[model samples]
Target: MLTLWCPSAASMESAKHAPVSPVLPSYEQEQHLHAFHACEQRHEAMARLLVVVWDEPGRCDLRAMTHVVTAHLRRHDTYHSWFEERGGAIVRHVLTDPTVIQMEPRTLGEVRAEDWQRHVMATPHPFAWDCFRFGILQHDRGFTCFASIDHLHADATVIAFLMAEIRSAYRAVLDGEGPLQLGPPGSYLDYCASQRQRAAAMTLADPEVKRWIAFLHRNGGRMPSFALPLGVLEDRYHAEYVHLDILDDAVMDAFESACHAAGARAIGGLLACAALTERGLAGRSRYSVVTPTTTRRSPKAFRTTGWCVGVVPIDFDVQQRAFPELALTAQRNFDERLSLAEVPIELVLELAAGLPTVGSVATGGVMLSFMDVNVPPLSAHIAREWHQANGRVYINQGIAAQVAIWLFRTPRGLSLTAAYPANETARASMHRYVKAFAGACRQAAEALMPTYSDAGREQ
Candidate 1:
């Protein structure tokens, strides 16, 4: 069992007026609003993964960690608005249990495979007005903390980045450095304001926008939903971490070669891997992956922090072409989507008022599967350290029960994980799917290597 301590009224009051600007809503927010409205109409729970990574100091100090986290909240507007926008509630909690903390292992592989499954199932949703709960686990080498956040509030990228920053702050405090001054906190409201200005200023749609609109028109304005195997409903969600080594020299060589040979960016390579994985799993061609693209294509958005992201579909037909060819296709699609990502999906839906809604598509028998490939700015050492971290590093959270795949890249290689509901497929089937996906990745990499080398020589 874990115990939680509520913050003092005085503390809450003082934290309320922290200096922060309001961010305008981006096109993404408009889409989310539409989705939320739809979900409200259907009364179905919106699922998301809430993850927490704690440092391995081997001690349990719920209050201390909370205090450290709270202090930073004072300086960051994003932190403040996050809690405020959610009805003046922060869905977060702190757990103080030495036994729980002691159970986590020090190394990534040593972490119990069942830990993730148990954590997700047993974890309770924070009350509509309460902050998220944080569970502390003790391992032989250090302590681990767990949190299951609601996806409706924030996606994994933001959550992961926030967690990493918090950990960095906590570690700095532990080292006797006063909390690092993270510059003036950017407000989400400000971002929203900027978005409004951009939208207002735009008169003509770009070519990419035209292409997307045409695609939407061809598809009849229905968004596809991924199908989950029925087996997922029976078994609990469990997580496993797999590590692959890509030495510094190898990573640099691979990065340069892939970029030059394919005329694609590093992220393109990651997407190509995802396409290969999907090809291996479905064992067919003509599949589409919906991925999130940051709307911060403009220089102004570079420094601004807000939820300015929208989903775009990348369609691939593996049977019709080779992996390299597919990689090029994926790259082209990604580039085009990024250019027009500023347009909100909600706006598109609104513009096509007579088109069928997502619900209607579900009723009409269209299955949608997606791959979210997150390639964070990777430095060689940081990638190595993540691989070295203890506990299972999972790429997928089986929240939708659909075949959702997540890819995280490091200097060594890519770490790919897929999550499916246990009730949806047999264990053998799931394993086979994973194996096939891995093989596709290897084939894609091998086929691209020579092309990359030849391009490098030409250069």
Candidate 2:
């Protein structure tokens, strides 16, 4: 099992003193600008990815760990980059000078990782520079590495990449080999420039832009909200987090087989299950959601530590449909929607001025993210080297009206993590929803049992 850790006073102080030397030529991307403005407008804890790296007992040398972190900060462009508002627009700022964040590992003491996570998340990091926080916690049996980076700078994929690099670096340093000579990660700023160029060449008449406009139009020209009622009226309140082990390996294996038999992938099967649960709980026949997708199309960005992600709206009717049928439709819908996944909703809003909105509809809507961690960089080192049982992503722990669910498929099993508004009614509602979701998933797996059984008999 992975453990948690908190930062010492010295480490926090180091973050404060980290210097940033700004270089010229600023660039902007829709997603980054939207995240920056949202951070500017909200005082609450924003979404961040919290990662914990496990190590042998008492073997977590502070000196070696500091070297590892300093080396990572130097290699990733995002770590050396920040944002600033200039003449009413948020622009990127890069630090050319040496950027080093000291790592001082203190004992775990009495502080729980959850509480410390909230405290660190609540404590704002500087957007001008050093927007990420890192720490180490030493325990009797072992030590763990802890770090948090907001949505503006990092996502789950980026976190996975960085953690693998850190593990490799830390191991090397421990063996007295020092930092590895891995080349710099692909520049996120260059990716942003490409995004701007692609967006610039398009107009309102472009099919992708029109498709987004239609999606918004279908949802009252705003982002889709949670169909279930949230009892709170306040804008900000305490948030509740729920982790559900939805399926064991055996059941998940059967479910994946069922999905294959039905001509759908496991992701599609899972989406069908979620849609069924939504319909059962809220009596809604239509399931609509904004799912996040990565934009790292270039192989060079396979290790880039940037927020190169986009949100795609997926919706389908789930009325009187069987599990396999719904799963197939969901898969097709999800696959077909990727053509416009790279198109930013902010750009869509900009080009289509006639679209109605009370305020920014770019965020604060129901979102679902799914990832099979067995892919590429994550699979290469996650379980073997990192063993990160506690390395999870945290989003919108502050006030929120909608629920955001992250589904991660690991070697162990498929698990669901959700964040929702904290209220008695919301809490009860989410638990029921989770239960329904799990039930639907199991039933889907069971439904395919007969087909497999018949095949076995025929053989």
Candidate 3:
């Protein structure tokens, strides 16, 4: 089984000597997964939320939707599992409660979209017993569902699956005149168990994972220079973030085509953009970006909410290449790293002993994530609008990092959210950086031919 990276030496020894973990072998979990682990280790709630409004009154069985969703939740231990910080390593305790899944009813027109954002900020989602919540807001127009989820339990992909499952369950409810029978869920624990077995096969002594650890070890880890000076002073519990709507439909389509043309994934392309931006402003040519990817290898795993995310750090040395060339290189690197993305962060932590406890040191420098909400298009839902706020930290965890760039692709195109420390100077710098990022991407998309693009490339 893959060893859990314990924050304490005592826990490490316990994991080594103990015959069987409190939970299953996989129950030890991927608590060692880069920044993904922090959701469990830290005291903060680390709550993430989602707001969905289904305007269409077409055969929408609210009760059935809730029923099937709750049924689905019961299937995955990861969602129901409450992780407690025991001794040193985290222990997963899975408990099922019917009260936890009820989607409460709320007065619809009363709650604005921004209100949901403020609500999550003002009242942090506690990581105590129940880690997930659902509420239905009733309005004059349509019905909206608000979900407050603990990041400790689910990452982006898991969250996506949760939303998709709800929609699918609603469909199933509609399909079966009354009874919504969701055939048995392929056990998520089994997946984790398999991962543990695979991890055992690929021991820490495996040269590939070890090489990465040693390579990052030399640079004193992936800690980047924290955000520029500006914004809220009290880092913790106060969110300092900016959201940008970068592309409309036409441009977004071209951007995707450009990604295909340039042979780059969305995350890699963004990394290339950020890298080129940094090269000009900071005179730094290369950037190491920690990209979080979901390891949804099976269709069954994709159907449930669970933590199978990995931090795939891509080193972007695109100083000499044109945007298209950078894209091709980034795509190649993304694929290679993803193929071996299972390398445990615990191993890296064990090797880099004294490194500063900062935000995701294993793949630090900057975290760039691209999420295309993997659900049926929003048009399918009956709702006037939809709102989402992902990874908005109320209190800064005091990780010395340059910035975290999150890219979300909606039907409207790209929504870029940048989170950094609260500093006036840093805010100004972030503005410039974002402007540069947008400009770089636009130019890159137009200049698909590296041969011609290199001439106009930003030096």
Candidate 4:
């Protein structure tokens, strides 16, 4: 639940008559194109992949489902937009027609859901058309609902917002309530226009730009990469996904307590563990990785469904430091870096010219993403419903040379999902990494439990 505002179909109908306009792409969108073209050179699809899977009790009515999905597509402007070249520049062309909503219906005869999902995920989206594919796979008792949207258009938060909308709309239609009267959705195009203005106002002397330059200089003019060997010499389209239940509620509670006692957010504990694990695995004293931060700076941006995310570089030493101390330090480092999260990576790269570009961008380097469903938007009350529905998100790691880890907390517990190159060497490395990470999590919680308990008693 990244946003509370849900747009209705009628709210966007007025835009159907507006003239088509070309908008400048955001930094994230530009990075996506860079990756996309790199993949094309290798005969692969660049994955801005997002997939959500859930189950419904009985066979869903295709016609009714169609109406609900159409409403969703019309609610968001990105769903009706695509990238195009206009006079030597890449721009997003937003369509004003409300009639064009992309939904590819498919029935699973005997094909596995995972296989079908991966197949659909690997195919490149038509650049001139809507980059969304929604389908239903019917089986005996029920059907699985699958939705995939290109990351260029929607991030995880946007996907969550969309899924919730669909669920509510579908349920209403089934119960004869029809469409809910959701508020008008915010336009991502407007956000992009503001970002362009922000970028225009920035200079090489800006403190944020200087900070980014220093960060890149520390890592040899590029973003830091995974400390350990991934055995990936080049980009490969195939990737393996792993999901593990890292911690149950009790342990997660302890972990949170420990983090709080050590003056750090719960995410700090995970970052500390990541640093230690990399050190132990590769003897690299410093842990460096790129992380995504939400750039929903204003209320309108928060309500808008688009890639409102920015990348930040984090680096810290993990040598001979205890979990709690390291966690605090990691938190401090994260806080300092987050202040500049709004600075576009494209600008950073431009200011720090002549820098080696290999393994520098977030897509080419190591990345860590964490989502706490217990927090706002995706709070436990809503998370409980999603868990009961067996809702899951998937990422297609097409043409990636690095590992990206996603950690999420649901009502059930803390879980880890990772995507890496789908080769034996990389798989083995990721497995080892996950194992070490899990152990680190428990160790951090156990090590700080006594102090946490004592503090609680004093209070």
TM-score of 2: 0.84
Where does candidate 3 stray beyond 4 Å?
1-66, 96-127, 171-176, 179-184, 200-204, 223-238, 351-364, 373-402, 448-459
Please report the candidate that would top TM-score against the real structure.
4
lDDT pick, better of 1 and 2: 2
lDDT of 4: 0.72
Clashes of each: 46, 0, 20, 0
Off by over 4 Å in 1: 1-46, 60-64, 82-129, 138-140, 196-209, 224-260, 266-287, 296-306, 316-320, 355-385, 391-402, 420-433, 448-459
lDDT of each: 0.46, 0.68, 0.54, 0.72
Q: Which is the better candidate, 2 or 3, if ranked by TM-score? A: 2
lDDT per residue (tens digit) for residues 91-172 in model 4: 6656666665434344445666476756556444635354566766767878777777778778876555566778778988
lDDT of 2 by residue, 1-459 (tens): 222223445544544454433332222233445554665587654444444344444656667776677667667776556656668655555545444344343444556767666545643443535556666655676765666666556767766667667877887888888568665579876776777788779898898887787777777777776767667754435578888777776677888888988899987898898889888888889888888878887657877887777777788999989899989998998898987778877777778775454234465567888887776656745644444444544454544445788887777668899888877887888888878888788788877665434332210
Candidate 3 weakest ten by summed lDDT = 1-10
Candidate 1 accuracy as lDDT: 0.46
lDDT of 4 at 267: 75
Clashing residue pairs in candidate 2 are none
